[model samples]
Target chain A: MSHQSKRIILKSFPQGHPKESDFEINTIEIKEDEVKDGQVLVKLLYVSVDPYLRYRMKQVDNKAFQGYKLNEPLTSICLARVISSKHGSLKEGDNVTSWNLTWQEFSIVKGEELNKLPSNDLPLSYYLHSLGMTGFTAYFGLLSVGEPKEGETVLVSAAAGAVGMLVGQIAKLKGCKALGIAGGKEKVEFVKSLGFDDCLDYKTVDNMDEAIKKFCPNGIDVYFDNVGSETLDAVLLNINDGARLPLCGSISNYNDTKEAQGPRRTFNLISKNAKMEGFLVSKYGKDFGKAQQEITEWLKQGKIKEQIDERNGMEKIVPSFIDLFHGRNTGKVVVKIADE
Target chain B: MSHQSKRIILKSFPQGHPKESDFEINTIEIKEDEVKDGQVLVKLLYVSVDPYLRYRMKQVDNKAFQGYKLNEPLTSICLARVISSKHGSLKEGDNVTSWNLTWQEFSIVKGEELNKLPSNDLPLSYYLHSLGMTGFTAYFGLLSVGEPKEGETVLVSAAAGAVGMLVGQIAKLKGCKALGIAGGKEKVEFVKSLGFDDCLDYKTVDNMDEAIKKFCPNGIDVYFDNVGSETLDAVLLNINDGARLPLCGSISNYNDTKEAQGPRRTFNLISKNAKMEGFLVSKYGKDFGKAQQEITEWLKQGKIKEQIDERNGMEKIVPSFIDLFHGRNTGKVVVKIADE
Candidate 1:
């Protein structure tokens, strides 16, 4: 017996921003004999669409992470079910998550690369967001790098996004004043509902520096920067003495053909005796288990909330991925390919 | 007999770069009987003219250090000889250093504010450069903040200036490869003569990014940034993974009426997992004695060199101060107001 599977493949590298033309949907026939002794055939239930994928679309040397090879099937974190297995660990009907899975309806992966999920009361799609990489990114970036103190003010950019939403909640849990900057009124309202003390819509704010001053009366102490552009410049001007800025992401410049322009902030940093550090979640890989445990407890206690924007079918994958660059979706964007 | 002392006063705050007119020289007659209890009349020998003084010439709130009050006598670090004293500490003809002395030929200061220098074989001017604030700043900013390790490449900007010169030497002593960036051909030659592994004249270099790549084959591990402009941008592009940049000064932007313009570098910091921190030398006040001891030994062992750009008289002070902005002088700029 044989099955036909659809996969998203890169057609061309983007010059500025990625477009539908940059990708191609290809169908391939996979025979049952393709599942080797150590491999499992997985039917992807949910595929994660993240902002970091935009970085992978550019062809550049010395990238922080390796860029996807040309003409190869795109890969991402995915929630899948084992349709059949020839491996010792995985078996048919097992729900698992794999970080190295192809963005396709069906994938043949090594059993050792997949982690079988224990049955939980939460929605299976939650594993693609709040209980997954997005949650872990916010965990280590805010707690370890930002190091928000009990009474300090923590400001997060892209507040309506997956990582930013969790960062604000975690900051609130730690007894810090959580403030957020998002793109629109709806995002502002969304983040405010997540217990942020204040949420400013950057799209409507006339002066970011003045707005920040009014909201953060004591000045920003811990700035978890996600949108690195004018917001970052304004924060630099209003940072408290000895402030800490953790550079987690720069979604604003991911599509830039040239380097982003702004006020040089080294002088501001010197005057305030501040520190700015850039980091990736992979740097905290050794401690992911600890973060996952704490986040799970918070979710069960109803102290944390997860927002997911899910799309139906593998054909919607490119649209879902493209939507991320336009800030079209709030929270985590996940594409559901099949039933678990 | 009364002495007529000429002092420099801030005529007005500078809009951009300071000019000679922004400072006014006033001659004030000090009566011989003005020396009161717990006070001393001191003749200024050497007055330090530093780049940080340019920042003091601006009127702005939240200044890292207090700006000079308009229409008031300018004060700075000075070497002085106590002419007379009414305090318990017998100080007739005693050589001392005072950080709070007015920029003039004579200053009447509280006796307690003076630190009597012990008899030493080093030149009197050495106390103003290699053995004073400059040395301590380089020590703490490089060793403590930068933390350059053995065999790593360390780069310093404004390499012919006081702090930059010592930072490179200290890095070399720590077994790191020391590279320097200076302005003119002569300045580049000066730093190269001081044992820096390589030196680049930023003024003459056509492409700074290419120059950095050429000089730093292994990429920069530690960057002591003194001039923040194109040099900073170039270094950001070539920094090694986990690089550390200690922002000691931003002399290039001090004269600008508007904020300095450059490429936003937070993204680069993230990709490289780098850290940049700003600091004031005053933050390390408690550890000055230990640094002074080590620097004095290094100087005596001929492992450290100090360059002095001396101006002849108190009248030449304003010109000397203005010269720093144009990079007309190298190392420590000091105005010799009187014989030591």
Candidate 2:
């Protein structure tokens, strides 16, 4: 069988911040007979629009996030359904998620790279949020690395966003008092609705330290950081002894053309005997299987809830991604490419 | 042996930075017969002059280091010989060291607080620098926290000073290539003579980054940091992946009257996947015995060397401490108080 698939390709390397001109929509034809061994041809359903993808577009010599080459397909998380399989475990109807999947209508993924999702149990988009990379990050970053203890006050920045929301919820579930900082009153209320003990609107809070002190009467013990400029700076002054900081991302400084005034907390850490660790979810490859299983169980048990801000059409991938920077979406932002 | 002993007392607290005017060192008559059971009367020889004493001079609400109150004698590391022991283990003329010893000519110490030094083996001052708090700090900071691996590059700031010098030598013994940062050419040569792979004088180097790169070509694995400001900022950029930084002291920013720029390394930790642990030797009280025994063994084998800059007279304590901020001393500055 011969088929044609539409995909987004990297047209050019980003100069500083990404522009729509950097990506091009292209159509490519493929044959079933040409399918490689240990590969599954998948029809893309939902693609993850993440902040790290923007860094990948820049031509920087970073070993952590290797920049995408010009004219190559842009890579992101994709929840896809296998249409054809040459792999041992996956069948034609198997639904899977791949970190390397592109912003395309269809993709030929390596069998090992694709994780088979339970078809009927959860929302297909849930795999893109709580039970996927976003949730796994929240779990590992909060539980394992952050080591939030019961009765501890946990502060999460970008709380209404994908990873931050789940991190605060997970911390709350573990008996920790959780507080979230978001851009608007709506996001703050949204985070509060998700069971955070307190929420702060960073846009309105002129003196973040004063606001944080009011909410966190004791002091912050665990800080799950995503937004890293002023929020981090304020959090630094409020951290208690033996505070754990899991620096998952710095979305605030990601697109900054010049060096943003980074939060200087090194001096605070000394006085408080605090430990701050920055890590990527990819580093925990050994525990991913266990993390996914636990997260999936949590989702089924209603221990955690997820909300997806759905954007329609594959053509909206760039716009959805750009919206992420502007804090326009709530929960996990996913672009639904097709109807189930 | 019915005798009266002299003691020093703090008549008042310092307003900004501590001065001689803040202290009224009065000679108190101590009747040795009044010493209670489980207590030992000691004749102090050497009083440890540490930079942390300055931090304690400030009136703060911090539980860890509450500043010295008005009319209270400052307590610090002291080398003393027990003149009377009522609790049995200690005897008259037995040399010892105490974490609880007062900064005076004579101290009434609890028997539990004193550790009897092996007088037949090592110098009593060896117990001060190599077997006492300084040694324990250097040992624990370098080996336990830093985790120095063989063939890895270990960089230490404030190298010719007390703890830094010892840390460099220990890193060398662990088969690591050691680089040190000192304030002058003389101190730089001094650290180099102690078997460090390289030593950089921050005073001479135009660019800290260039100097660090020149010394640590392979990048730093373990950084025994004493000076934590611009020097630390430079080390942060050059640290290798999974690097360990034992935050022993931040002497550079200790006395900063102005809001000096804090060390910029949080992003480097994210990029390099490095970990900087701020620790105090007091926190590891459980393992102090094991560390002391190992350090004592190392000292007997001539594997580690110590340098002490002894200042004669008790009145010199305030001036000697002031000199520490100006980078005046070459080694561990000890105040030798004479008994008349």
Candidate 3:
């Protein structure tokens, strides 16, 4: 097992959009032979670049972010393979995903925080994608919070992106008319091909309200929101009675230093008997496998597709994460850290 | 049976706050022998003066304000007694309530909307209060939407006033420690005596968040919100995890021509996985009787107490409605159109 590890640490917190100046990559030496009992040495195969990670960089007293201490390695969901294990139940050559590991290589993790991935005749990347946090987020945010029903119209913002595409596909499987709002013609075509009934290029639309009304004549019944700004405001006005809004992530406002521009149609929630809730996938750890089983089957059956925008090598990791904020990456953004 | 009747008609739509100029009093001759088969002449006794009626005064394309056509009589819920009945189901001298019927000395009402008062001994005013729309709003907002649990903290803004008072009492009955926010010292004392664990005079408070924290150290579980400006912002900061906020009304900014200036905290719903929903009592009219039965039983057994701010004469109706915005009325505001 490799003892020394190279990891990215936050040198300082950025004001809004995280600058490269905020991060410092360093190689730390670890004595592998000094590995204590109940700990496994893992080689991180893939690291996730999520919008939520940007929130963790900010020091806010919020449940979603337990303040990211300065000069520390930022952590989210990382898929790692246990190369050598001293833990009771773990073994060598085991694939496990942990929500507590890093943006680094050679992570030492506790056994309790790790879950052994099931063996399937699918790509190992699916464990970090369609059958992972992104897929489970779509399931819980739509079913538990959004409470989507069959025959209802669902409008998803960032619909061609990783979580959004999965949300639209899952909602379609539930018999809902899925509408996607993306940034460009390519992403719009991409989401439409992924099974959304209609895909709108928000960049091309002059009037969002008219564009939304054209797609949802009966009004939006369920809103799976990933982008919350003017898009949320537009969706709010077209909501029907008893509409449910699941706040997945607000990538649109992640970089705003001050409060984001106030949404124009926030009062619509009161008038329409609508409700909006925010949730993190960590809250659904108990029921992850239940969603994983369904998502895995869908992936295996080709009912749900996986699209990864994989950047090569550990050197490209920071740029891949930064590209997420600039809307450059489509589908799941993962950095291939090392060989499988 | 009287052949003459007096009615109030809307001469024009109100530009802002409704004034005496917006309405006209008129007398019409009713043919006593021409009464329809399912119709009864009801002599009006009590007319409810609600804040929602003010919203109806401003012409708008909303369900609450369906925009009155010129020179038509304005109508709302009125507790009345059958003066004469051509309908076999209702006899003369029966106490009843109906949403239909003109604001007048006498008006004809169909049998469908009319409900005879419960024969069990209770104040006739209770029909306008703890047994009617006010009760249903509290029951559904607190029990169903707010979802209060025993020992969990419940906060009601405008607590001593109308729906807030009933909601606090109901929360108390459900074993929650209830807190109320009222305008004056008297109203705070009044709600305190009604079994609320604590009451804050929001008018006198220097910092409402500090005051609320003093009352609810465990953090807020359910917030029955009728005032939706700054108070809601304070509640947003104090909400516990998985809190439910049922937005009953926003009397605070109902009359403002401009959007109210307050900290918008819809984003807080995401961090706490909290839910905020706006509701109308009519949406749950199907279960009104079920809720009314429980409230009436409690009222009859002296398990709950109530207060009514009664103003005599139909001409005083405008003042009664205005009192709601001023937070001067406690419990229910009822206009005594005539002595029974």
Candidate 4:
């Protein structure tokens, strides 16, 4: 028997912000009997849409992260259930999570590469976000790189987003004064509800540096920088002596067609004896198990919280993903393709 | 009896590059009998002219370093001979080093604050440069912050200057490949003579990034930045993953009338997972004794070389100080005020 599956494919590379035209929906027929011996056919239930996907849409040959190829199905972390199994480990009806997932409703993945999710009371989508790559990113970026201490002031940019929210909450748990910088008032309110000490609406501020100075009187000791353009510059001006800046992402400049120009602030770092370091979550691959265990425990203890902005149906994936770049999503953007 | 002391004073702060008119030579009569109980009158032999003094010439108040007071003598590290003693320790004919010394033939310094140099075969001016703050700056900035590993490529800017020369030699001693970026062909020859693997004349190079790419094929692992301007921007593009940049000085912007503008390269730091940290030599005050001992041992073994640009007479102090900004001096700039 042959099954028809719908998938989204990259139609063209984007020069700046990605548009719906850059992606196209295609229906392909796959024969169930053609599944390889070591492969299992998975029925994808949820697909994660993240800001990093924007960087992948640009046609650049980055060794660290390769952009998606044209005419190919885009891949991301996905939650799936085994519909057919040919491998020894995976069987029909087994729920699993894998990073090697296509945008298609059905995928054939190697059984050995699939992570079997534990049957828990928490929702399965949590595995795609809070207990997944986003959580690991927040854990290593804040704890290892930023190294926030008790009584220190920690500032997080893009506070309403997935990694930023986790960073703020984790900093608060570590006894640091956590402040969030979000785009809108609703995001400010949302982060404040997530137990951030305070939230600044960057969209409303006349001058970001002055606003940061007013919020963090002692100056920012540890800055978890996600949006790395003007917001990063503002934080640089008000940083205390010996400040640590962990460069996690630069969503602000992802769409920049030309190089960005700003006040050269390296002098500030020299004057204050501060440190700015860039990092990626993959650097901590060896210790992901430990980080996952701790974050899962924190989730269970109510010390951490997870928020999701979910849209129904695979057809809404393109718009939902585009909404991330516009800063319309309050938390993790997920597209629910099917019910588990 | 009264002694007429010819001292250089800041007539006014300069808007950009300092001029001779901005400094005035004041001959003040000091009554020898007026020396305080805890003070010792000393004849200044070698007064150090450093690049940091230019930053002090600015009127803006910096908590890390203070500007020189107007109508007062400019102070710097000086090699002196005690002529008269008012307290217990210092005595006539005792050679000492003190940071409290002024740009004058004679200075009155507190006896207890003077560092009594041990009798050695090394030149007395060596106490002002190599075995002094410059040596300590290179030691801590390179080994402590940079932490260059064996076989790594270490690039030093302002390679012919005091701190930079020592940094290159030390990096070589640590089994790292040392590359130097200097201004002219003469400085390139000078640093290359100090066992540097290669030297780039930044003035002659039309494309610094291409030059760096050619020299450091594997990319720079550790960059000891001194001249921070366009050169820094070029290095930012070719930094390897996990590169360490120890920001020691930014002599390029010391005379800027306005804030510097450059391509915002923090995004590059993010993609490479690199770290850039700024530091002051004074922060390692407690560990100076240890660093001084190690540097002195290296100096004695002929493993490290010291170059001095000695100008004759105390009257030449102002011009010698000004020459540092012009990149005229090849090594430590010093004024020979008197001889023992």
The prediction achieving the highest TM-score against the true structure is: 4
lDDT of 1 by residue, B1-340 (tens): 6899999999999888788999999899877688999999889999888888888877877467677999999988889998999878848898888766898777778999988886778888877887888888899999999999999999999999988999999999999999999988899999999999989888878998898888888899999999888888889899998999999988888889877785466577888888889888888889988998898899889999889988888788889988988989889888888886
TM-score of each: 0.95, 0.90, 0.96, 0.97
What TM-score results for chain B in every one of the models?
0.96, 0.93, 0.94, 0.97
Q: Return whichever of 1 and 2 wins on DockQ.
A: 1
DockQ of each: 0.66, 0.44, 0.48, 0.68
In model 2, where do residues sit more than 4 Å from their true spots? A1-5, A9-40, A85-91, A108-112, B1-41, B70-73, B82-96, B107-118
Quantify all predictions' global Cα lDDT against the true fold: 0.87, 0.82, 0.82, 0.87
Candidate 2 residue pairs that clash: B10-B71
Q: Tens digit of lDDT per residue, candidate 2, span B15-113?
A: 545666777667766678878999999888888888877777766665566567767777777888888889689999888888767777776778888
Report residue B294 deviation for candidate 1 (angstroms): 2.1
What is candidate 2's lDDT per residue for A1-340, written digit by digit as tens? 8668888999987666677887899998767777689988888889899988877876777767877888888888888898999999999988888888877787777898998987666789988888888888998889888998899999999999999999988988899999988989889889989999888887987788788778778999999989777778778788888888888888887877765666665667767777767777877778987988888887778888788999988899998998888899889899999876
TM-score of chain B of 1: 0.96
Model 3's CAPRI class is acceptable
Better of 1 and 3 by lDDT: 1
Each model's iRMS: 1.7, 1.9, 2.5, 1.7
**Candidate 3, residues A126-195: lDDT per residue as tens digits?**
7778888888998899888888899999989998788999999989999999998999988998999998
What is the descending TM-score order? Answer: 4, 3, 1, 2
Candidate 1 per-residue lDDT over residues A15-72, each given as its tens digit: 7778888899999987778899999998989999888887877787756766898899
Tell me the deviation in Å of residue B53 in model 4: 1.9
Give the backbone clash total of model 2: 1
**Two-chain complex of model 4, DockQ on C-alpha atoms against the true structure:** 0.68
